[model samples]
Target: MNIKFSGVLVGMVAVFAATSASASPRPDAGHYEWRAGTQAPGPRAPLAVARRVWVPAAIAMTDADVCQSMMTAKSGAMACCASHSS
Candidate 1:
């Protein structure tokens, strides 16, 4: 019985040590490769254009206009600009 218990304990310790060793994050986990002349393939172009155009337009727009637009788009539930009146 003692030999059997010792064998089980040793097996559990070995498994635990193996798992703990592999649980650590790799050193190059955050590294990314950026290649030249390669555009990111997605809806990123429309979003980028919108950011360059829409952001400045939105910033220049009145607070009331922005709040009304948000309310209309989001079913009249505007928690962010609720205090502003159009």
Candidate 2:
């Protein structure tokens, strides 16, 4: 395509985009803003750490390949992934 044609195409897209944006409402226009912080936070419990969680050290790309590798490596998350993937 010639430069003139490409320029016209870009100009048309810009025009449409500008019109659409002007017609659309502002993102935060209808939302409520929360400002209340009068109440104090309750007591927090100490975090517990797992000693023997089987998280995989090696990373793989595909879901099936990851499952297989993790299964071989005995990762606990792979067992959980079986439920989610199904």
lDDT string for model 2 (2-54, tens) is: 99999999999999999998887554344443443344545563344234433
Model 2 TM-score is: 0.31
Model 2: number of clashes? 0
Using lDDT as the measure, the top candidate is 2
lDDT of 1 by residue, 1-86 (tens): 99999999999999999999888776434444433443445975433222121111123344766656653435545644535434
Task: Tell how far residue 50 is off in model 1, in angstroms.
Answer: 56
List the candidate 2 regions with Cα displacement exceeding 4 Å. 25-28, 32-86
- Model 1: residue 48 alpha-carbon error in angstroms: 55
The C-alpha lDDT values of all candidates are 0.55, 0.57
User: Model 1, which residues run further than 4 Å from truth?
Assistant: 27-86
TM-score to true structure, per model: 0.31, 0.31
